[model samples]
Target: MVNVGLGHAELSSTHSNGRVQEERRNEGVVTSWCIAKPSTDDESLNHNIDYSCRQKGVDCRPIQPGGSCFNPDSIISHASFAMNLFYKSAGKNYWNCHFNGTGLIVTQNPSWGTCKYPA
Candidate 1:
């Protein structure tokens, strides 16, 4: 069991293949992760985006709304001025996958993209 603070806890169990199963959390409630799979259309779109990011050498993880590209060093790798410029050119939809303050909020649309900073 891993405590995430404020009464939030995550419990993991190993599968036969040595893969860890993660419990899905929704507003503190637990649910089946597979049940949360996106619709076919949305799934394809996300897959395309994920492929694009990967082609650029960006390590990204798929989330409910969209995906997040992260640098290996996380915070340290986020100090690139060129990256900032790239994100700016990528428009308001592109987000920094580092700082929690503003990167990409996954709950707003949950269809295409979401704002990093909630208003």
Candidate 2:
């Protein structure tokens, strides 16, 4: 989700079932944050991601087979998502994006093709 203005309404577009739908509403204020990792696999990153998922009880079902985030599924992809969730839950602060060297913070939205990141 993107905030159009300060205390202003924003339009959200959702693509589902071959149709594009849009709506206006105020859900929550969003700040720009992106957690990215290298293509190379790292054990520490995996460990942090796993511990985060279990400890926080994050709902990762959306990344499962037949789920919304299932496409382009990979360890790195899912880990980035989980890390982002952790940051968002913690109030979208710079510190929240720090996952003990597991991620890098970027100003970009980090939303992939058809994969909407929490704003």
Per-model TM-score, in order, reads 0.19, 0.63
C-alpha lDDT of candidate 2 relative to the true structure: 0.55
Q: Residue 19 in model 2: shift from native, Å?
A: 17
In terms of lDDT, the best-performing candidate is 2
List the global CA lDDT of all models.
Answer: 0.26, 0.55
**Model 1 alpha-carbon drift over 4 Å, by segment:** 1-14, 24-51, 54-119
TM-score, prediction 1: 0.19
Q: How close is candidate 2 to the true structure, as a TM-score?
A: 0.63
RMSD of each: 15.0, 8.6
